[model samples]
Target: MTMRAALCIWILAAVICVGRGHAIVKHQAEQDTVVDSRANTASLVNAANKEFVFRLYRKLAAHADSQGKNIFYSPFSVSTALAALSVGARGETHQQLFSGLGYNNTLLTQENVNQAFQMLLDRANETTRGFINSGTAVFVDNKFKPQPEFLETLRQSYLADGFNVDFTKTTDSENTINEYVKEKTNGKIDKLVSNLDPSTVMYLISYIYFKGQWASPFDPVLTKEDMFNVDENTKIPVQMMNMEEELHSYYDQGINTTVLQLPFNNSYSMLLLLPDDMAVLENDISRGHVTKWLKWMRPRRYDVYVPKFSIKTSYSLNDVLTGMGMTDMFGDRADLSGIAEGQKLAVSEVVHQATLDVDEAGATAAAATGVGIMLMSYRHIPVLKFNRPFMVIITERNTENILFMGKILNPKME
Candidate 1:
């Protein structure tokens, strides 16, 4: 699948349909000496970033789960994995891989996009108080020697953790992949790759981990078992935490959904999205509606009730990715020659594993995400009860870069 795959998956969310092959171009850096400070460049980069995150979520949310199952992953994580590979991608291999990851070669340069993510990561990791981390790595078969330029780009741009191993030694190699995932995600995701195909040339992955403290702590003493309406037919008990004080929030009258922003000490926030209808996940959420909803939000205080929940999800993104126009890199026509001297390279598997934990204090998450690669929002506080299926997002306040997202279809499913 190439840019035209964008045509096949266009309806996953209408946001990305505009990215046609010839019509769209890679991102172009503004002709400024300090590109980061250029307002126009920053705005375009932010829009592209948000569009990419929303695009990935719309695609995954549509196909990654079965009926009644909750799902979550870092779009950034998946994109990061693909971005690392893009460093070594060439010819159609580079186009398909980068395009699938939402890079329009005509509109933005990889360097421009990479710099945007780098800035976002730096902003997220600026202080160690509230943690958000994204890193890349390559598990190469010892037989292959990666191009120095490819390795250098990964190191400089993505802060990669590169490794070499004998793919023929399945036991040791598998352990190595899992161990790296385990260590990077602070142990939240221990095993991402189970087995490496003997013919597998290299396995690339990215990991993201986040843990944030609520600006205003929810009192555990207020926690009580309550019913969360999964739907009209199913109501399950959940440990509900309450914050009675007025809190900032946004309520979209059009969608009849309420959005609440809970801040962290480190300039990050977990945005909760609660809609009256539980079946919204099955329906395509309008992209522009969310942008408007976020813009409309103003600080208004109100009481809030949220459940204490924990859940984990894992996926093989091959089909989902191909469905979204990323077909070439996984197949023979792939030209990942930029990675090595002469041996042809193609991705064998893309795996993602994610987990989320939320309580009165805050939210913590870890995972190995696919492009299995690696990677937010607003609110108001009018008295709200998240007594049904809702959504949660962790993001940086400045760039609004999403670190993680989850759809709690059934709070008790975990």
Candidate 2:
């Protein structure tokens, strides 16, 4: 049996800031000087983001709802949205956001984080090796006015655009926000907002759309139907894409996992990990393990089989973020004074949606986060068949930033 395969994923997150008030500023500098001064900051931010990625992933995996199910998300997208929100955060709210994002332990200050995000946003949106479109937008209620410093900060540091909407007209407001996200994600995310809160003074959204062709495209003719073991007793048919080539691979004896590195035409690559015991791998996996795996990988020729599959996941991250020490942002005690001076503002909702599709041509992904905020791989040669559950991590080669990460328990389950 043969199956058609195409890799395309979408992620969206939205944050709803509820309050009433108004505030406005502007500055510009020589582009050359700005870039030179922030040259080292991007890597620092990227490191912090990576640490948060695994921590968040472990949290997601531990959720009861995620048991025996496929997981997919864009950590970079979520971080970007929260980082943008942090601009308007004050006191404990800011500290919670900082610590929750794993930036507190680092040497980075808030300004450093902003500069790094600015650099990353610029690089991601550039028409370079692959198609990566990342952007942020704030939808403000016409009746509400944010602080001048807040808006200016978002615009300068996060590359965010501002729009005015009448929140009283919920449907219209939702459509406006959704349409912008849909267009940015190439229609990969069409319905990003629904049932807008009338009290909401602002809505912040962050989205990332990525489409990349594989460096070594798989021949469609070589794809054949095969069986995937979902568990001990369950098996499902899948379109297993096959290829035999010299590829970077590693076998970690400590955790009994096989790692494979699949490059994209751009400066990105997918790392796949198939483990003998998923529990052991999950418990032991960390940044150190990933660094070691990359360092230990060697080029080798092997027969590889990857299931062509697509999966979509939606998460309500309020509980997860709260569990991760981001409690103040969602409660009555929340202090977002920097956003608006006279009004009490708190985050009412956070939603994240992501989708992934993998095929012979390559992989394409889109993610959106709304505050209503919300917030790989591989292959084998040596008869490395992904016949069972495995992990997928897509990372940028130069920055070492993890663009997306998840686990595939069953390709047939979207």
Candidate 3:
């Protein structure tokens, strides 16, 4: 069963905020060094988040709306938003969130989860090589006040900001929240909310933005028009970027997949998987496969052809979250009383948006000498062309956290 190649790319930056009882936060800090049990717990949480990432990916991929379309999102952004909501959730609502997030099996307590998130947030905000800004905030209705303890948890554990907006002023409220998101994401997402529901007491939102250049930049002179096979019966024109370099790659004979690692100037890397059967690979892929594939990859010189493209995606994940056993939080039975007393509150919506761009440039200009050397040795190398649909995953090398994950079914589709 030979399936077409699929491209999966991961990018960075995330923001989470809420209104009414929901909040969003944006965090940025200098890199710090630390060795403690909290750090260890953070590592464990990161691993569990990986599981959440794949489970969520499969769920989204199976959605009727996602069929034969491009899928891109920041799992970290969604998870962080829900985790922030969990701070004020009580009883069954909290339990469901913990289970849905794949945290019930672990030995982590609520406080532990908070601390672990804080540690991870600090690390994610560190911008040593590339730009990564992650944060959460809560936008509360002016008429309703949230409990002090709940806000404190969000501020301390999630590094979130708190705001009170008058929901009655729908347009003003929407602009306030959307402008904040636009600024944090570097204008990647201009509008995050629209047609505000007057009954909405709180809005929980999460966002991320990432920009990185290839370690071995492609030469634009070598890029040319190429036909990209979207599927068996469809093809589209794309500007395919070309490069020849010694890149780390592996072929899993058992699964009939070829994995390639493309590093950024930062500590992050994009892992591209080309499988013989897209369905089979998607069904069988797990964190274990990712770890094994990375471990087994060895460097080899190849002439690679990749499409230069940009994509943006937006999703309303209420149904998806409900299907994942997080139903109570969106219903009247939701125990969000912890967020505010004497007022009924429930999450009305959960929104997520992300964008990514790839081109022939790095943080610094591509080395002219390096390009010349690669051109000199290009003839004997094997060719690896990404002319078909494939999967892409962006991950932090040190923490092994999957910042973003998606498949490119059609590059021309925005």
Best by TM-score: 3
Tens-digit lDDT track of model 3 for 1-414: 321111111122332111121222433452344345667767777777899988998888888888888888778877887888888888899999989988853577778788788767765665442355666767777766678998899888777777888777989989998898788676767777678766556665555556666777788899999999998999999999898889999998878888889887678788888888888877888888888877788999988988888777777687788889999887777777678766656666665676667667632222232433255482578989888988888887665778788888887898
Of candidate 1, the 10-residue stretch with the lowest lDDT total is 6-15
* lDDT (tens digit, per residue) of candidate 1 on 1-414: 321110000001100001111111225765566754544444555676566676777767768364468877776676666766677778887787767766678877767766655554454455543355566666767766778887877766666667888877988888988787777666766666654566665666666766666777777777999999888798888999986654567777766677888876566677888876645633545446555655677875566789888887777777877887878877777777777755655665576777778877667532121111010013543468888888877666655666567688887675
Choose 1 or 3, whichever is better by TM-score: 3
Alpha-carbon lDDT of model 2: 0.76
User: What does the lDDT come to for candidate 3?
Assistant: 0.73
Give me the displacement of residue 11 in model 2, in angstroms. 7.1
lDDT of each: 0.64, 0.76, 0.73
**Candidate 1 lDDT score relative to the true structure:** 0.64
**Candidate structures ordered by lDDT, highest first:** 2, 3, 1
The C-alpha RMSD of each candidate to the native structure, in angstroms, is 9.2, 10.3, 8.3
RMSD of 1: 9.2
